[model samples]
Target: MMLPTDPAQNLAKLIRCPSVTPAEGGALAVLEDMLKPLGFAVARPTFSEAGTPDIENLYARRAGDGPHLMFAGHTDVVPVGDEAAWKHPPFAAEIANGEMYGRGAVDMKGGIACFVAALARHVEETGGPSGSVSLLITGDEEGPAINGTAKLLQWASARGEAWDACLLGEPTNPERLGDMVKVGRRGSLSATLTVLGRQGHAAYPHLADNPVRGLMTLVDALLDPPFDAGTERFQPTNLEVTSIDVGNPATNVIAARASAAFNVRFNDTWTVESLQAEIHNRLDTASRRRKYRKDRKEPVEFELAWRDNPSHVFLTHDDKLIGTLARSVEAVTGMHPALSTSGGTSDARYIKDYCPVVEFGLVGQTMHMVDERVQLADLETLTQIYRRFIGDWFGSR
Candidate 1:
């Protein structure tokens, strides 16, 4: 059987699957079929938790007796919000004016497709690599991220699977295909701070203490001082107040409570524990200071709750992985890709615990946005880069 050589074709097949988050939607099945012909043993394992959806994950490996390298990504794409807003049908994979438009064209189905194409070309020309190659794909990356890469990694490890290094095919480039490569990612933590107060008629000015005033003070405390000056590899830690809500619509009534939700994308200088302590310290100090009305001076009666799981900050410095990928990008694009840690968290945050990981793929300017698309040239360019990196990495190993 002739293996598909064009990454665009591979991507087209994937884009047509409509595998929106947590849905198998035939995305992984198409991949399994494609890899099976290339001597890969593919497994589709569905994992379940009480509250989350049953997630289907794909683990495909072609065996060899040398150093092992893994490519990690997700098959699921984000929802096509307001289908009418798209220029083309979101799942149609229509190509026009040298670009293909679809929901996962870049944010990552394109990366997976190009990797497969590159591997196929490598196998056809040189008869596979000196080392083994495996793909750790999950259908949960765009969802709660619960039973996805985290569990897939554990499941694979339990079965005696090991990897020397892993590269995530996430959209790391900001503008052009080879403009950037993510060497690391900042950690993310979210909190909801709810402050309590006595609710009463607004006309009765002295009857109730307003919680909004207190919540504002606490927020100021959190943002006034910069978290830290940042580290050499990471940007300064930033805390954004995503939302502030008292949920009171009445003009005359003072809401009994006010809640503000904030998220912090921190750097290596702070761990989750230390950051939590720092937040507590700031809130405590702000609430204790008699900055509010003197008569209502009481420690900000607030409840703080941490949100979903936090992603830990990590940087990969392995010469074999980072060095090889850098060379590959420079060779293909004629520009040295900037090694950056400037982006939202990804599943790479989870994989970092098991193996050294880096991220490189198509441009991300269109990811998760309406009219998501990728240039046709980029698909082939990325494929060649992956092909070269594979040969060089294993050749050296």
Candidate 2:
């Protein structure tokens, strides 16, 4: 079979793999074959942890002597919910009405396919970049992220590998190919707050302290005065209560406990320790306030537990990487993509510690949907953008 040159074809081949989260599912196998022909040294490392499933990741590099550039992405995708709901089989790679439909079509096997195609095109036209180019592709991005880019970067850096800049091909475009590029991401902090109280009869006036009332008081304080006004580069810090529960089944019973879980997506104005300090301060002050029972003056007993590792807010300021990608996008699509720091966290969070990193990729309107798909036209357009970026980036060096 002739080697496919178009990103759409490459995307089709990738979509044919069933590489759902935490599963290799032959996706990396397909990539290994493609990169080998381009003279890339590909390494597949399977990383494992006690609780998390072992993840197979690919790190491919074509050696050169100038500034090293790395492209980061994940081959693993979220589960295709209700496969029968799709217009075509989720893994069939069916092309219909000018769209290739399948799981990972846009979030983001599509991005990976485009980058590889662009690399191939770059080599054919200019005989490779002046500097080394590498890919930190992971299969655990959609899972717990235990054995993925975080460890991979550590592994690579330990071996004296350093990157001048990194680009994450997460689906950044909200609507169209040249619409947006992510320069930074907000930090995320999740926590569960539980308030303890004594169970009592509902009819009693001064019998038990209701932790539900205390929880409401705290939640109010957390959300009332906004964390901060919108910053120049990021939105205002926002906290949301995800769950509030009292386990008591009977409505007449005053529950012994009430718990609430909340998450805060914050900007650079605060660090994890500072933000957490603010939360504790709020809880401490609120817990001491008067209860609804009026006579009971004892403070609310509460416990707070953090969930998952909090991601630190990060911004990329590399002129070469940002300028090259921005210029390339304009040249390819006649639109200057907006430089944004407005999105949920991505693997770039991990890559940021290693090097300056940015994110740009396919339009993501259909990601994680029933018929996740990518437009054939957008695939080539993004490929051309990446190809231009490669030429301009390496040429500038």
Candidate 3:
């Protein structure tokens, strides 16, 4: 069947796939069919790890000689919370009130649709650019991320495919079509702390050590002094205690151990190693000050474990890439875009390691929500923006 070249129809077809994380749902197949006509040589690699389910990702390129540019996004969508909550079906791709409704419509099957349209138009108009363009679409962006961009990039590198720069089609704009582009993201880390004590009757204070008291004191020490004043482009490092538990339900019995979990969203002032060391110092110092345990003469007993790899902080600094995308947005929408680094992380975190990357896409008001949809006009406008960006990026070089 011949696919529709119209951006809206193409997006509706993608939305119909129901490509919730780790599932192809025929979304990648649709993309392969679309790209074949555009002369891109497409490769679908299904990457896997021990614990994570295998994910299918696409790497397609139009063979050429000049600077290589890549556009990256996910075909996956988060699950629809309660299907009955939607005014229209989640995968129906229904149009009403001047908007197209469905999952991934705005957060970003719409992005994929627009970019394909832009590329199709660019190829038709200029007979292809001096350089090459490629697409990196993954099916695991919303999952554990074990088998997604991190592995796909490695696979591509093994085949000698390297990119000069990349543009991520995440929903970076908040209020309008051309209001923002994400330039960086703050780092994140999580840890668990457990403090041990003696269990005894509540009334017999002299016989038992109260771990709750020690845990509260340690938590206070970490929170009282702020990590740092805000950095130039990022907010200050902030710590949040997600949970505290003793698991004891009795009114008169003391618990044996208290556990607490906390997360930190930090800025450039600290690296993953330095921040971890600081946490250990504070905990050890707090433990030392409270050493005379009734009769034992020892500090509070505790254990700490770092849960996951710290998300490394980074900023995109390529002038041509950032400037071209910004200019494209302005030219299409007549609005200057803001280069921001103040949101949660995305697949771009991994892509940044390979090449300078930035994110620009549709307004994100309805993403991952009931009746998720996009205004038809916005899709066309975004396509125009990408079209202009593709022309400018390769034309200038």
Best by lDDT: 1
TM-score of 1: 0.98
Kindly give the number of clashing pairs for every candidate: 0, 0, 0
| TM-score of every candidate relative to the true structure | 0.98, 0.97, 0.94
TM-score, predicted candidate 2 vs. hidden true structure: 0.97
Residue pairs with clashing backbones, model 3: none
lDDT of 2 at 19: 93
User: lDDT for every model?
Assistant: 0.92, 0.90, 0.88
Error of model 3, residue 181, in angstroms: 0.8
For every candidate, C-alpha RMSD to the true structure in Å: 1.2, 1.4, 2.3
Worst 10 residues of 3 by lDDT: 288-297
**Residue 210 lDDT in model 1?**
90
Q: What TM-score does prediction 3 earn?
A: 0.94
How displaced is residue 42 in candidate 3, in Å? 1.2
Question: Alpha-carbon error at 161 in model 1, in Å?
Answer: 0.4
Best-performing candidate as measured by TM-score:
1
Question: On residues 155-269, what C-alpha lDDT tens digit does candidate 2 reach at each position?
Answer: 8888888998988999999888999999999999999999998889999836877888888878888997988997899999999999998988998899999999999999999
